[model samples]
Target: MNGERTIYSILHILNGKKSSQTIQDIHIFQLTSLYQSFPMLSREQLEEVIQTLYKEKWLVQSLDNHYFINDTRKGELENLLKDNPLPNYLNGWKFHAITEPFWQRLSLFIQVASHLSGNSIRYIPVQRNPVTQLWLKETLHSIAIDRSNINKYLYKDLVKCLEEIEINPAILINRLTGLKKIGLTSDQAALEMKMDPSLYQLSFLAILHFMIERILSNKEDYSLLCYMIEDNKKNYTLTASTAKTYDLIQKGHNIEEIVHLRNLKQSTIEDHIIEVLLNVPAFPVHSLVSEEKMTRIKDSIEQSSSKSLKVIKQQLPDVSYFEIRVVMARYGDS
Candidate 1:
């Protein structure tokens, strides 16, 4: 809460809202790494947390009614963060879509393999997704493993990856179900590791995100691990609606034409354009915005500290909000 955005905007960003404003906020605030990191964070949960902060005197309201970190408590919070910082691998904007599927697939596969190796077929599945189960069935046939060697192959690949990545494997290993063991739930694992429950869950996700990026990068080194996540391809950053808009845009349809053809509003199509530009950097910004307009917006951004659209708009009254958004989406990071 830097007073640039309301609490609702922060909530939306954590919830991974697909709104144009939220998407732009991720770039403008340099919070793309935290984008969609907490899909389970409900509005009520955020409000409760805010209330607790207020009660603890860690957050305070200004005369303008804007919420901000209390100057007196900020140092303590910063010190705590410095002592036990957030995990390294948390590119939620990029990996949020795939992390769950990757975890489900790996968890289910491990559970099934553990049962098979133990000569016991009575245990319940760790992952109950039908799609994940179907994928497991298909993958079992496709991979180079059978009942006799399931544990050996799984162990070798698992150890190889953990050793190479050099993360504390307990966060990952504790969540995995195996032959004589039922996997620990996130909270249970957290307690076992003497960590805060929230941190444990985030660490679990960070490891999964980290593993996904690593496996995809060096498929030759982690053949078995790579096979498990073959479905997690690179093209997953855009929303479904945005993907449709992206396809049509690539086909060379103008905004108005796309609006008429897709029956979407003009604003919605423009939002999709911003999303496209942010994710696909090679798309030409000049096609949608003039060089002069882009220059003005960049200048306004240089003077804008809060990254508030209203503040930026007030300074450049003639520029349409959409035009300013176009430049911010294109070169805000640059």
Candidate 2:
């Protein structure tokens, strides 16, 4: 039932196009973009869902290599979903998923709980699917056996927060570990609780957020947690233009090729490359800059009072802005 509802949500987004819109056929790329926003399904899973929908006559393919919602079923699904609206957190989750700091903090929370529980568990970064299960298991286990000050505080604080929010603390425990003491999927838990899956997801997120806030507030006392959650020493992010350019580059496009394909100026493409180089640590800096040129740029910046690009550009007048940008990208603060 949850899978069917997920499919309906996808259809709802697809069918949201204006009636007079010419882009009737939803392309695979468009669906992939939509998945980034919702992220409830992977591309492979989405393809499988699409196939199932096609079999059920809920979706149809066009000659243009695109898909569309079946007109007859569209209205009925839309009305049903309207009564049980999609969670407001659907889009917000996308940002949290992409933000490295958020996951780092969550991973620390799990690791701390595991250690305090005497589980000797190694911490791996939390992924979207199993976060709730991991949180509930480790937290409960810590509370049960460990009488450490931190564990006791965490247990008490979480209980107080849940109670204040008017959510049954036991429901989380029961939902995650059903009658057999095995975990249930979010969908199965939703069914057991007689709540909409979307609502359950939102509720879970709220609880998670409250716990996170409580932990973060006492970060000084929870120094290990704070250290673990800190962003990589050099925090950086790609701008929108750079992100597009980086995607093209990943697809094996050269600067000229990217400029041609994107219909952007060569200089603009170069600027985007610089942005990518500056922001992405694993980017092959050596590929773009020679050791000699990098040294020269670094030396020039160190000598200059101002770290401005224009200042550096004046020092290396013969160099193009693109080359100077590469130098700045390597040496400058993000």
Candidate 3:
């Protein structure tokens, strides 16, 4: 849909409002300002465009003298006006338009597939729009049927990110889904689930429980991260100022005591310290602490009290909680 002549003027007015408007209550103020800006427009021409937009359902005026940009038309206008070398201006409508049959076909395919997961409707109020809900549901169901396609679409950087993180994809996949019961070793299952034989390099990221693992794995794969670690370590080694800062922090220095530490601001120092803690691999997921049965995992690891893998494994054998200490050890934290 083409933007009405007053589009820029209305956008400027809306931008001035600190808060967004309720759709029904925005018309006269915006329109009046737009008219004032374009004094050359005859009253008839001004009225004609507004009335025409309203008639076309692109501009909706409610019972309360309020106006709203129609959802579909607004999306079309935004796409057309988007900042790009090839803005969706010429024959873009043909490329951009969506239809029921297209979505239906995709949905049918997703449903018949077994390996795919994580398919669902996002951002739309499916409950209120029955027709749209059915269309979306069917599309998602079809996408799920073709597991590889769904995984590819959903996880665009899956393989590359996984390898970058230094995680054996086979191990991670096996961990995600317990395959031992199905007579499949985690290693075997992970290998089977590996995405795209061609582009197999996974980012250190994109793993479920290994946000920190990604950082550590990347440090090993790329030397830049190693340099960062070494540089930070050198500061601790050579700089008396750095040593004093650590001492102060260890001695419980408050913000006021730590503000004068060189060019680094107090906030920056605090952030650096927190970043260190953020990547601790003590447990792959932090939520383990809140689970009633799992609080002991931390206490057990911290004290270095000897506990067999068999004993600890019994508490939460299949869950990642049991593997937290292992992850921590891998990162040299243990």
Provide the TM-score for each candidate, comma-separated: 0.91, 0.40, 0.17
Tens-place lDDT digits, model 1, residues 204-295 = 87888888888888788875677667555454468789999999999999999999999989999999999888888789889988888888
Clashing pairs in 2: none
Ranking by TM-score: 1, 2, 3
Model 1, residue 62: C-alpha shift (Å): 4.7
Model 3 ranges off by over 4 Å = 1-199, 203-247, 261-263, 276-334
- lDDT per residue (tens digit) for residues 1-334 in model 2: 1122244445434333211110111121123123223335455666676788889998777633256678899898899879865433232212333333444344445445545556445444234446544554554565434434454554454455455555544445543321124445668878888887756765555444444454455655543333333333443445567778899999888888999999989877876776566447688877777777777778886787654467778887766666666766555542
| Residue 125, candidate 1: alpha-carbon lDDT | 81
Report lDDT per candidate: 0.82, 0.53, 0.36
* Per-candidate clash tally: 0, 0, 26
Provide C-alpha RMSD values for all models, in order.
2.3, 15.2, 26.6
Ranking by lDDT: 1, 2, 3
